[model samples]
Target: MIDVLAPAEAIHAAPELGAVYLSAFGAPGYDEEPARAEEFATEQIPLHSQRDDFKLVVARDAGKLTGFAYGFTGHRGQWWSDRVAAAVSPELADEWIGGHFEVVELAVVVEAQRQGVGAELMAALMTDLPNRKALLTTFADDRPAPRLYRRMGWKVLVPDLGWDSALYGLNLGVPLGH
Candidate 1:
């Protein structure tokens, strides 16, 4: 089963989360991703722990941690992104960095890769999200992610364009009785 975990103060006070993340992605030689992940886990995670715009969702099978997905809002002035802050909608581009839901990270363990855990996590995240539109990035040739997003009726804007990364999106309506 998958559940969206509330980021508590305890979890944010240690490096275990980053350890797990590094284990999943593998720490290569000093590179951009490692440095970036380091900054994200340390610098931003604590903020996320306290912000309404951020969430961390985890997937467990038989009580063991298998994967997680993290998301937060994007706003206009501080729309923090490595790429251009293009809007999923017409106004998203010009919006504040912290006002739109943006998926910051997602991953599944190797043993759990084909088990639909990612989909389940996404569904649960969608169930808990505070908005209808979400912005996210994934590898262009990612065998299953893009395909699954497409199957789920997500809109794909800004094609690969031969970039190192590709972005995909979904809209989660914040509705009552979720």
Candidate 2:
């Protein structure tokens, strides 16, 4: 089962969850790698989430965390393309992490991969949404993540290698994408 959780509570599992995120993304892709500092990345998440636009969803099965998804509304200095970012983002950039419903993170435990946990988490994402779309990003083909998003009807709008993550849009209240 999956449930939307608060950042405060979600942070409690950070060390464990962080380990997982770091492990998967630590060395993803063949010739590309993140250029940002790990400390900065780690700190930005919990801190950025303090904004009102930030929301996190956690999935647990029998008391064990299987997966989680997180995102916020608008963010400042949109890196990829302000126009494209605004189109797919949950909220305006000035709204910061909490302004929009941009899913910054989503992961299922290694042992739980290939299960329906991820899909369940994503389903939970749209349960209360009023927006027509939402943005989610992940390493381009680093794993099955991008493919899964595509399978769910998410389409890539901004192709940014510098972002090191592929940006996707989900039509929340509309028919699945083509």
State how far residue 127 of model 1 sits from its true place (Å): 1.0
Candidate 1 local Cα displacement, residue 176, angstroms: 16
Cα deviation of 175, candidate 2, in Å:
5.3
Q: Report lDDT per candidate.
A: 0.62, 0.62
8-62: candidate 2 lDDT, tens digit per residue: 7756666555654554455344322343324424676677568545667777778
Per-residue lDDT of 68 in model 2: 74
- Tens digits of per-residue lDDT for model 1, 1-178: 7666667731543254564466556633213366655765787687666655667788767876777777776655443452446423445444423455777666666567778887777766666566657777666675677776676656666566255456665656633222
- Model 1 collision count: 13
Cα-based lDDT at residue 88, candidate 2? 47
How accurate locally is residue 66 in candidate 1, as Cα lDDT from 0 to 100?
A: 76
Q: What is the TM-score of each candidate against the true structure?
A: 0.73, 0.70
